[model samples]
Target: MRLAWFSWLVRNFGGYGFSDGPLRAAIGAGAVLLTAFLVRITLHRHRPAAVAAAGLTCALGFGWLAFH
Candidate 1:
């Protein structure tokens, strides 16, 4: 499960270790920043196609995360 994987990650690389809340907040912030950067660049060049592709990618990513 995702929680198991996250725990493994924390154990391996979290140094003194981290509480889940702060770690999750940091990761979520990073994801949002990365998504915004990618969308800004792609949207400027590809317009409608970029938006569609981004939407599809997000849906697929969420589905995979939820099911796998």
Candidate 2:
């Protein structure tokens, strides 16, 4: 289940861009990081832990994809 989601994320990393190699990798990492940062900052105060968890998940996913 987790492998499926990870592969999906990796597949989409190059789905919409005219980039390749390190450029594509950088773009993918930036997209994930920025989206996670926005979510972390915009969540309700009552869900602080959820926001942090989501951010950490995204960061880890980015790192994994960046080096995978």
Candidate 3:
């Protein structure tokens, strides 16, 4: 699952552009990172698992709905 998703991300957003897939993983990654930063700033604590989950969800959602 992880490898497939990784491949999809690289193949879509790396250099494909609109030929096959949308290059929106960059946007997704940025949004996810921004959300993580916001969470860290508001929570005042560092929990890697929680931040990872949030980022993963954001990335997946963006990929499925927006990036696809």
Compute the lDDT for candidate 2.
Answer: 0.70
Candidate 1, superposed: residue stretches over 4 Å from native = 1-40
Those runs of model 3 whose alpha carbons end farther than 4 Å from true positions after fitting are 1-22, 45-68
lDDT tens digits, residue span 1-68, model 3:
99999889667654433334445545655666677667655655657766666676666655554434
Provide the lDDT at 21 for model 1.
61
1-68 in candidate 1: lDDT tens per residue?
99999887667543422334666646654565577558756787778877776666666554433343
Measured against the true structure, the TM-scores of the candidates, in listed sequence, are 0.43, 0.46, 0.38
Error of 1 at 59 (Å): 0.4
Cα RMSD of all models vs. native, in order, equals 9.1, 7.7, 5.3
Per TM-score, the best of the predicted structures is 2
lDDT of 2 by residue, 3-33 (tens): 9988887787665342357676677777787
Higher-scoring candidate on lDDT, 1 or 2: 2
| Candidate with the greatest lDDT versus the true structure | 2
The worst-scoring run of ten residues by lDDT in candidate 1 lies at 12-21
